[model samples]
Target: MKILIIEDEIQLVQSISEYLQTENYTCEYALTYRQAVHKVLKHNYDCILLDLMLPGGDGMQILEEMKRLKKMDGVIIISARGAFEDKISGLQIGADDYLSKPFHLPELAARIYSVVRRRNFGNSNIIDENELQINLLAKTATINNVELSLTKKEFDLLLYFISNRNCVISKNALAEHLSGDIAGMLDNYDYIYAHIKNLKKKLNDAGCRNYLKTIYGSGYKWEI
Candidate 1:
Protein backbone atom coordinates (compact mmCIF):
# COMPACT_ATOMS: atom_id res chain seq x y z
CA MET A 1 0.00 0.00 0.00
CA LYS A 2 1.05 3.61 -0.56
CA ILE A 3 0.68 6.55 1.88
CA LEU A 4 1.09 10.28 1.64
CA ILE A 5 2.32 11.98 4.80
CA ILE A 6 1.51 15.69 4.90
CA GLU A 7 3.40 17.21 7.78
CA ASP A 8 5.94 19.98 8.26
CA GLU A 9 7.83 18.37 11.12
CA ILE A 10 10.91 16.94 9.49
CA GLN A 11 11.86 14.53 12.24
CA LEU A 12 8.34 13.18 12.70
CA VAL A 13 7.89 12.68 8.98
CA GLN A 14 11.15 10.78 8.71
CA SER A 15 10.38 8.54 11.69
CA ILE A 16 6.85 7.77 10.53
CA SER A 17 7.93 7.10 6.96
CA GLU A 18 10.66 4.73 8.09
CA TYR A 19 8.30 2.82 10.38
CA LEU A 20 5.68 2.50 7.66
CA GLN A 21 8.37 1.29 5.26
CA THR A 22 9.17 -1.51 7.66
CA GLU A 23 5.53 -2.55 7.39
CA ASN A 24 5.85 -2.87 3.58
CA TYR A 25 4.12 0.42 2.77
CA THR A 26 5.34 2.82 0.11
CA CYS A 27 5.45 6.39 1.46
CA GLU A 28 5.57 9.82 -0.17
CA TYR A 29 5.77 13.05 1.83
CA ALA A 30 4.89 16.70 1.52
CA LEU A 31 6.22 19.32 3.90
CA THR A 32 4.09 22.26 2.80
CA TYR A 33 0.43 22.72 2.03
CA ARG A 34 1.10 23.51 -1.62
CA GLN A 35 3.18 20.40 -2.04
CA ALA A 36 0.55 18.33 -0.33
CA VAL A 37 -2.14 19.65 -2.61
CA HIS A 38 -0.05 19.01 -5.67
CA LYS A 39 0.60 15.42 -4.63
CA VAL A 40 -3.02 14.71 -3.81
CA LEU A 41 -4.04 16.08 -7.17
CA LYS A 42 -1.48 14.02 -9.05
CA HIS A 43 -1.41 10.59 -7.48
CA ASN A 44 -3.54 8.04 -5.68
CA TYR A 45 -2.64 6.81 -2.20
CA ASP A 46 -4.13 4.07 -0.11
CA CYS A 47 -4.09 6.42 2.89
CA ILE A 48 -3.02 9.91 3.81
CA LEU A 49 -1.64 11.07 7.19
CA LEU A 50 -2.68 14.71 7.35
CA ASP A 51 -1.55 17.37 9.83
CA LEU A 52 -3.95 20.21 10.58
CA MET A 53 -1.42 22.97 11.22
CA LEU A 54 0.43 23.39 7.95
CA PRO A 55 2.86 25.99 6.68
CA GLY A 56 0.62 27.77 4.18
CA GLY A 57 -2.89 26.53 4.98
CA ASP A 58 -4.95 24.61 7.46
CA GLY A 59 -5.19 20.85 7.03
CA MET A 60 -8.95 21.25 7.21
CA GLN A 61 -8.76 23.24 4.00
CA ILE A 62 -6.87 20.39 2.40
CA LEU A 63 -9.61 18.06 3.51
CA GLU A 64 -12.12 20.34 1.82
CA GLU A 65 -10.11 20.30 -1.38
CA MET A 66 -9.90 16.52 -1.24
CA LYS A 67 -13.63 16.30 -0.84
CA ARG A 68 -14.15 18.63 -3.76
CA LEU A 69 -11.91 16.46 -5.86
CA LYS A 70 -14.01 13.43 -4.94
CA LYS A 71 -10.97 11.43 -3.98
CA MET A 72 -11.69 8.21 -2.10
CA ASP A 73 -8.30 7.88 -0.40
CA GLY A 74 -8.54 7.10 3.30
CA VAL A 75 -7.35 9.89 5.58
CA ILE A 76 -6.24 9.96 9.23
CA ILE A 77 -5.69 13.27 10.99
CA ILE A 78 -2.36 13.08 12.81
CA SER A 79 -2.29 16.41 14.49
CA ALA A 80 -1.28 17.82 17.87
CA ARG A 81 -4.79 19.24 18.20
CA GLY A 82 -6.29 16.63 20.53
CA ALA A 83 -9.43 18.47 21.55
CA PHE A 84 -12.76 16.68 21.26
CA GLU A 85 -14.01 19.33 18.88
CA ASP A 86 -10.98 18.93 16.66
CA LYS A 87 -11.58 15.20 16.43
CA ILE A 88 -15.25 15.69 15.79
CA SER A 89 -14.61 18.26 13.10
CA GLY A 90 -12.12 16.06 11.32
CA LEU A 91 -14.43 13.07 11.33
CA GLN A 92 -17.31 15.18 10.16
CA ILE A 93 -15.23 16.51 7.30
CA GLY A 94 -14.21 13.03 6.02
CA ALA A 95 -11.31 11.70 8.04
CA ASP A 96 -11.51 8.03 8.77
CA ASP A 97 -9.65 8.32 12.07
CA TYR A 98 -7.89 10.83 14.32
CA LEU A 99 -4.53 10.19 15.95
CA SER A 100 -3.25 12.66 18.47
CA LYS A 101 0.45 13.41 18.58
CA PRO A 102 2.69 11.61 21.12
CA PHE A 103 1.01 8.45 19.94
CA HIS A 104 2.62 5.04 19.51
CA LEU A 105 3.87 4.12 16.04
CA PRO A 106 2.20 0.71 16.25
CA GLU A 107 -1.12 2.36 17.02
CA LEU A 108 -0.76 4.66 14.06
CA ALA A 109 0.02 1.72 11.83
CA ALA A 110 -2.99 -0.14 13.10
CA ARG A 111 -5.23 2.82 12.41
CA ILE A 112 -3.87 3.21 8.91
CA TYR A 113 -4.39 -0.50 8.32
CA SER A 114 -7.97 -0.26 9.49
CA VAL A 115 -8.78 2.77 7.37
CA VAL A 116 -7.18 1.30 4.27
CA ARG A 117 -8.93 -2.00 4.88
CA ARG A 118 -12.29 -0.30 5.25
CA ARG A 119 -11.75 1.70 2.08
CA ASN A 120 -10.33 -1.00 -0.16
CA PHE A 121 -11.57 -4.37 1.06
CA GLY A 122 -14.74 -3.39 2.89
CA ASN A 123 -12.91 -4.16 6.17
CA SER A 124 -12.26 -7.76 5.19
CA ASN A 125 -8.78 -9.20 5.67
CA ILE A 126 -9.27 -12.01 3.20
CA ILE A 127 -9.79 -11.56 -0.56
CA ASP A 128 -11.55 -14.22 -2.56
CA GLU A 129 -11.30 -13.79 -6.34
CA ASN A 130 -12.63 -16.90 -8.05
CA GLU A 131 -10.11 -19.71 -7.54
CA LEU A 132 -7.55 -17.38 -5.97
CA GLN A 133 -7.73 -16.74 -2.24
CA ILE A 134 -5.57 -14.28 -0.34
CA ASN A 135 -5.33 -14.12 3.43
CA LEU A 136 -4.13 -10.63 4.27
CA LEU A 137 -3.39 -11.57 7.88
CA ALA A 138 -1.16 -14.43 6.86
CA LYS A 139 0.11 -12.58 3.76
CA THR A 140 -0.48 -15.68 1.74
CA ALA A 141 -2.02 -16.27 -1.71
CA THR A 142 -3.40 -19.65 -2.66
CA ILE A 143 -4.75 -21.09 -5.89
CA ASN A 144 -7.46 -23.67 -5.40
CA ASN A 145 -6.32 -23.97 -1.78
CA VAL A 146 -2.72 -24.76 -2.75
CA GLU A 147 -0.36 -22.21 -1.33
CA LEU A 148 2.22 -20.61 -3.55
CA SER A 149 5.67 -19.92 -2.15
CA LEU A 150 5.96 -16.25 -2.94
CA THR A 151 8.55 -13.75 -1.79
CA LYS A 152 7.48 -10.65 0.11
CA LYS A 153 7.73 -8.38 -2.92
CA GLU A 154 5.91 -10.89 -5.07
CA PHE A 155 3.10 -11.16 -2.59
CA ASP A 156 2.81 -7.39 -2.33
CA LEU A 157 2.70 -7.12 -6.10
CA LEU A 158 -0.03 -9.74 -6.21
CA LEU A 159 -2.11 -7.86 -3.70
CA TYR A 160 -1.62 -4.64 -5.61
CA PHE A 161 -2.83 -6.27 -8.79
CA ILE A 162 -5.72 -7.99 -7.10
CA SER A 163 -6.90 -4.84 -5.40
CA ASN A 164 -6.85 -2.95 -8.68
CA ARG A 165 -8.00 -5.77 -10.85
CA ASN A 166 -9.12 -4.98 -14.44
CA CYS A 167 -7.35 -1.63 -14.37
CA VAL A 168 -4.31 -0.95 -16.49
CA ILE A 169 -1.61 -0.04 -13.97
CA SER A 170 1.30 1.92 -15.27
CA LYS A 171 4.81 0.59 -14.87
CA ASN A 172 5.82 3.76 -13.04
CA ALA A 173 3.16 3.14 -10.41
CA LEU A 174 4.31 -0.43 -9.93
CA ALA A 175 7.93 0.64 -9.63
CA GLU A 176 7.14 3.33 -7.08
CA HIS A 177 4.93 0.95 -5.12
CA LEU A 178 7.74 -1.60 -4.95
CA SER A 179 10.81 0.60 -4.39
CA GLY A 180 9.24 3.42 -2.33
CA ASP A 181 11.57 6.43 -1.92
CA ILE A 182 14.33 4.87 -3.97
CA ALA A 183 11.91 4.58 -6.89
CA GLY A 184 12.35 8.27 -7.63
CA MET A 185 16.12 7.79 -8.04
CA LEU A 186 16.13 4.65 -10.12
CA ASP A 187 16.23 4.90 -13.92
CA ASN A 188 15.76 1.26 -14.74
CA TYR A 189 12.63 -0.88 -14.42
CA ASP A 190 14.26 -4.24 -15.01
CA TYR A 191 13.47 -5.26 -11.47
CA ILE A 192 9.77 -4.78 -12.07
CA TYR A 193 9.94 -6.93 -15.18
CA ALA A 194 11.81 -9.64 -13.30
CA HIS A 195 9.34 -9.75 -10.44
CA ILE A 196 6.34 -9.74 -12.77
CA LYS A 197 7.86 -12.55 -14.74
CA ASN A 198 8.50 -14.60 -11.64
CA LEU A 199 5.02 -13.95 -10.30
CA LYS A 200 3.44 -14.91 -13.61
CA LYS A 201 5.47 -18.12 -13.81
CA LYS A 202 4.58 -19.13 -10.27
CA LEU A 203 0.87 -18.60 -10.79
CA ASN A 204 0.79 -20.23 -14.21
CA ASP A 205 2.77 -23.21 -12.91
CA ALA A 206 0.25 -23.70 -10.14
CA GLY A 207 -2.59 -24.36 -12.60
CA CYS A 208 -3.90 -20.80 -12.55
CA ARG A 209 -5.00 -19.07 -15.71
CA ASN A 210 -2.98 -16.15 -17.03
CA TYR A 211 -5.12 -13.31 -15.79
CA LEU A 212 -2.27 -10.83 -15.90
CA LYS A 213 -1.94 -9.12 -19.27
CA THR A 214 0.45 -6.60 -20.78
CA ILE A 215 -1.08 -3.67 -22.62
CA TYR A 216 1.60 -3.16 -25.26
CA GLY A 217 3.31 0.20 -24.57
CA SER A 218 0.93 1.04 -21.75
CA GLY A 219 1.45 -1.33 -18.76
CA TYR A 220 0.02 -4.45 -17.10
CA LYS A 221 -3.50 -5.35 -16.06
CA TRP A 222 -5.19 -8.10 -14.11
CA GLU A 223 -8.27 -8.91 -16.22
CA ILE A 224 -9.82 -11.74 -14.25
Candidate 2:
Protein backbone atom coordinates (compact mmCIF):
# COMPACT_ATOMS: atom_id res chain seq x y z
CA MET A 1 0.00 0.00 0.00
CA LYS A 2 1.11 3.61 -0.59
CA ILE A 3 1.58 5.85 2.47
CA LEU A 4 2.40 9.53 2.73
CA ILE A 5 4.14 10.67 5.92
CA ILE A 6 3.74 14.36 6.68
CA GLU A 7 6.24 14.73 9.49
CA ASP A 8 8.73 17.51 10.27
CA GLU A 9 11.23 15.59 12.34
CA ILE A 10 13.96 14.35 10.06
CA GLN A 11 15.08 11.42 12.18
CA LEU A 12 11.57 10.28 12.96
CA VAL A 13 10.57 10.51 9.31
CA GLN A 14 13.57 8.47 8.21
CA SER A 15 13.02 5.83 10.84
CA ILE A 16 9.32 5.49 10.05
CA SER A 17 10.00 5.41 6.31
CA GLU A 18 12.62 2.70 6.72
CA TYR A 19 10.43 0.61 8.99
CA LEU A 20 7.41 0.80 6.68
CA GLN A 21 9.59 0.00 3.67
CA THR A 22 10.61 -3.24 5.38
CA GLU A 23 6.91 -4.06 5.74
CA ASN A 24 6.39 -3.79 1.96
CA TYR A 25 4.68 -0.39 2.07
CA THR A 26 5.45 2.36 -0.41
CA CYS A 27 6.24 5.62 1.45
CA GLU A 28 6.60 9.25 0.45
CA TYR A 29 7.53 12.07 2.82
CA ALA A 30 6.77 15.76 3.19
CA LEU A 31 8.42 17.66 6.02
CA THR A 32 6.33 20.81 5.70
CA TYR A 33 2.64 21.49 5.31
CA ARG A 34 3.02 23.03 1.86
CA GLN A 35 4.78 19.98 0.58
CA ALA A 36 2.15 17.81 2.20
CA VAL A 37 -0.65 19.71 0.50
CA HIS A 38 1.09 19.47 -2.83
CA LYS A 39 1.49 15.72 -2.53
CA VAL A 40 -2.07 15.14 -1.35
CA LEU A 41 -3.45 17.10 -4.26
CA LYS A 42 -1.22 15.44 -6.83
CA HIS A 43 -1.31 11.75 -6.03
CA ASN A 44 -3.52 9.09 -4.55
CA TYR A 45 -2.44 7.18 -1.45
CA ASP A 46 -3.87 4.31 0.53
CA CYS A 47 -3.30 6.22 3.76
CA ILE A 48 -1.57 9.32 5.10
CA LEU A 49 0.28 9.70 8.43
CA LEU A 50 -0.23 13.36 9.32
CA ASP A 51 1.36 15.32 12.13
CA LEU A 52 -0.80 18.02 13.68
CA MET A 53 1.95 20.52 14.28
CA LEU A 54 3.87 21.50 11.17
CA PRO A 55 5.94 24.40 9.92
CA GLY A 56 4.33 26.77 7.35
CA GLY A 57 0.77 25.66 8.28
CA ASP A 58 -1.26 23.51 10.63
CA GLY A 59 -1.68 19.92 9.52
CA MET A 60 -5.42 20.15 10.08
CA GLN A 61 -5.63 22.68 7.24
CA ILE A 62 -4.17 20.07 4.94
CA LEU A 63 -6.80 17.63 6.12
CA GLU A 64 -9.52 20.19 5.44
CA GLU A 65 -8.22 20.72 1.94
CA MET A 66 -8.20 16.99 1.34
CA LYS A 67 -11.82 16.76 2.37
CA ARG A 68 -12.68 19.72 0.17
CA LEU A 69 -11.20 17.90 -2.76
CA LYS A 70 -13.47 14.96 -1.97
CA LYS A 71 -10.48 12.66 -1.77
CA MET A 72 -11.18 9.31 -0.13
CA ASP A 73 -7.65 9.08 1.28
CA GLY A 74 -7.46 7.53 4.74
CA VAL A 75 -5.66 9.64 7.36
CA ILE A 76 -4.09 8.88 10.75
CA ILE A 77 -3.18 11.88 12.86
CA ILE A 78 0.13 11.67 14.77
CA SER A 79 0.79 14.50 17.13
CA ALA A 80 2.51 15.30 20.41
CA ARG A 81 -0.80 16.72 21.60
CA GLY A 82 -2.58 13.88 23.35
CA ALA A 83 -5.35 16.00 24.83
CA PHE A 84 -8.84 14.53 24.56
CA GLU A 85 -10.03 17.59 22.64
CA ASP A 86 -7.30 17.21 20.07
CA LYS A 87 -8.23 13.60 19.41
CA ILE A 88 -11.88 14.47 19.19
CA SER A 89 -11.29 17.30 16.78
CA GLY A 90 -9.18 15.11 14.55
CA LEU A 91 -11.86 12.47 14.36
CA GLN A 92 -14.52 15.10 13.84
CA ILE A 93 -12.49 16.33 10.88
CA GLY A 94 -12.46 12.79 9.40
CA ALA A 95 -9.19 11.35 10.65
CA ASP A 96 -9.43 7.58 10.72
CA ASP A 97 -7.15 7.06 13.73
CA TYR A 98 -5.09 9.16 16.11
CA LEU A 99 -1.62 8.32 17.43
CA SER A 100 0.20 10.31 20.04
CA LYS A 101 3.88 11.07 19.70
CA PRO A 102 6.40 8.70 21.37
CA PHE A 103 4.22 5.87 20.16
CA HIS A 104 5.71 2.51 19.19
CA LEU A 105 6.40 2.08 15.50
CA PRO A 106 4.78 -1.33 15.61
CA GLU A 107 1.62 0.18 17.05
CA LEU A 108 1.54 2.82 14.38
CA ALA A 109 2.00 0.17 11.74
CA ALA A 110 -0.86 -1.82 13.21
CA ARG A 111 -3.17 1.19 13.19
CA ILE A 112 -2.29 2.00 9.62
CA TYR A 113 -2.99 -1.58 8.64
CA SER A 114 -6.31 -1.50 10.45
CA VAL A 115 -7.38 1.70 8.73
CA VAL A 116 -6.43 0.44 5.30
CA ARG A 117 -8.12 -2.87 5.99
CA ARG A 118 -11.35 -1.14 6.90
CA ARG A 119 -11.22 1.32 4.02
CA ASN A 120 -9.97 -0.88 1.19
CA PHE A 121 -10.32 -4.50 2.25
CA GLY A 122 -13.69 -4.40 4.03
CA ASN A 123 -12.00 -4.91 7.43
CA SER A 124 -11.61 -8.61 6.59
CA ASN A 125 -8.54 -10.66 7.32
CA ILE A 126 -9.01 -12.75 4.24
CA ILE A 127 -9.51 -11.44 0.68
CA ASP A 128 -11.23 -13.67 -1.81
CA GLU A 129 -10.98 -13.19 -5.60
CA ASN A 130 -12.60 -15.91 -7.63
CA GLU A 131 -10.60 -19.12 -7.02
CA LEU A 132 -7.77 -17.25 -5.35
CA GLN A 133 -7.81 -16.71 -1.60
CA ILE A 134 -5.36 -14.63 0.39
CA ASN A 135 -4.82 -14.51 4.13
CA LEU A 136 -3.81 -10.89 4.58
CA LEU A 137 -2.70 -11.30 8.17
CA ALA A 138 -0.75 -14.48 7.46
CA LYS A 139 0.46 -13.14 4.12
CA THR A 140 -0.30 -16.42 2.39
CA ALA A 141 -2.06 -17.27 -0.87
CA THR A 142 -3.86 -20.38 -2.10
CA ILE A 143 -5.47 -21.29 -5.40
CA ASN A 144 -7.84 -24.22 -5.78
CA ASN A 145 -6.89 -25.29 -2.26
CA VAL A 146 -3.23 -25.59 -3.23
CA GLU A 147 -0.65 -23.35 -1.61
CA LEU A 148 2.15 -21.78 -3.57
CA SER A 149 5.56 -21.05 -2.10
CA LEU A 150 6.21 -17.49 -3.15
CA THR A 151 8.96 -15.06 -2.32
CA LYS A 152 8.06 -11.98 -0.32
CA LYS A 153 8.09 -9.72 -3.37
CA GLU A 154 6.11 -12.24 -5.35
CA PHE A 155 3.42 -12.45 -2.72
CA ASP A 156 3.22 -8.68 -2.37
CA LEU A 157 3.07 -8.26 -6.15
CA LEU A 158 0.23 -10.73 -6.41
CA LEU A 159 -1.65 -9.05 -3.58
CA TYR A 160 -1.29 -5.60 -5.11
CA PHE A 161 -2.46 -6.77 -8.51
CA ILE A 162 -5.43 -8.58 -7.11
CA SER A 163 -6.39 -5.64 -4.93
CA ASN A 164 -6.40 -3.43 -8.03
CA ARG A 165 -7.85 -5.96 -10.39
CA ASN A 166 -8.98 -4.74 -13.85
CA CYS A 167 -6.94 -1.55 -13.55
CA VAL A 168 -3.99 -0.90 -15.79
CA ILE A 169 -0.83 -0.51 -13.73
CA SER A 170 2.24 1.01 -15.25
CA LYS A 171 5.58 -0.75 -14.87
CA ASN A 172 6.94 2.24 -12.97
CA ALA A 173 3.96 2.28 -10.63
CA LEU A 174 4.34 -1.44 -9.98
CA ALA A 175 8.04 -1.04 -9.26
CA GLU A 176 7.38 1.87 -6.93
CA HIS A 177 4.71 -0.09 -5.05
CA LEU A 178 6.95 -3.12 -4.77
CA SER A 179 10.25 -1.31 -4.22
CA GLY A 180 9.15 1.92 -2.52
CA ASP A 181 10.53 5.41 -3.30
CA ILE A 182 14.07 4.24 -4.01
CA ALA A 183 12.75 2.37 -7.03
CA GLY A 184 13.40 5.50 -9.08
CA MET A 185 17.17 5.11 -8.66
CA LEU A 186 17.14 1.67 -10.19
CA ASP A 187 19.03 1.32 -13.49
CA ASN A 188 16.13 -0.51 -15.09
CA TYR A 189 12.77 -2.14 -14.36
CA ASP A 190 14.15 -5.55 -15.29
CA TYR A 191 13.33 -6.92 -11.86
CA ILE A 192 9.65 -6.18 -12.47
CA TYR A 193 9.71 -8.40 -15.55
CA ALA A 194 11.36 -11.17 -13.60
CA HIS A 195 8.84 -11.02 -10.75
CA ILE A 196 5.85 -10.88 -13.11
CA LYS A 197 7.19 -13.82 -15.12
CA ASN A 198 7.79 -15.90 -12.00
CA LEU A 199 4.39 -15.04 -10.51
CA LYS A 200 2.61 -15.99 -13.74
CA LYS A 201 4.50 -19.28 -13.93
CA LYS A 202 3.71 -20.18 -10.33
CA LEU A 203 0.01 -19.44 -10.66
CA ASN A 204 -0.32 -21.23 -13.97
CA ASP A 205 1.47 -24.27 -12.60
CA ALA A 206 -0.99 -24.30 -9.71
CA GLY A 207 -3.87 -24.68 -12.21
CA CYS A 208 -4.79 -21.00 -12.24
CA ARG A 209 -5.40 -19.26 -15.54
CA ASN A 210 -2.96 -16.47 -16.37
CA TYR A 211 -4.98 -13.43 -15.43
CA LEU A 212 -2.08 -11.02 -15.80
CA LYS A 213 -1.89 -9.25 -19.14
CA THR A 214 0.92 -7.20 -20.63
CA ILE A 215 -0.53 -3.92 -21.84
CA TYR A 216 2.02 -3.66 -24.61
CA GLY A 217 3.93 -0.37 -24.66
CA SER A 218 2.21 0.69 -21.44
CA GLY A 219 2.21 -1.69 -18.47
CA TYR A 220 0.15 -4.59 -17.08
CA LYS A 221 -3.42 -5.40 -16.16
CA TRP A 222 -4.84 -8.12 -13.93
CA GLU A 223 -8.33 -8.96 -15.13
CA ILE A 224 -10.82 -11.73 -14.59
Best by lDDT: 1
Residue 151 lDDT in candidate 2: 94
**Tens-digit lDDT track for model 1 on 25-105?**
899999999999999989999999999999999999989889988998999999998878999999998999998886655
lDDT of 1 at 14: 95
- The local distance difference test score of each candidate is 0.86, 0.84
Give per-residue lDDT, candidate 2, residue 40: 95
Give residue 215's lDDT in candidate 1 (0 to 100): 91
Tens digits of per-residue lDDT, candidate 2, 20-93, equal 78667899999998899999999999999999899999998998888888999999999998778989988998
List candidate 1 segments past 4 Å from native.
127-224
- Evaluated at residue 125, the lDDT of candidate 2 is 79
Candidate 1 backbone collisions, by pair: none
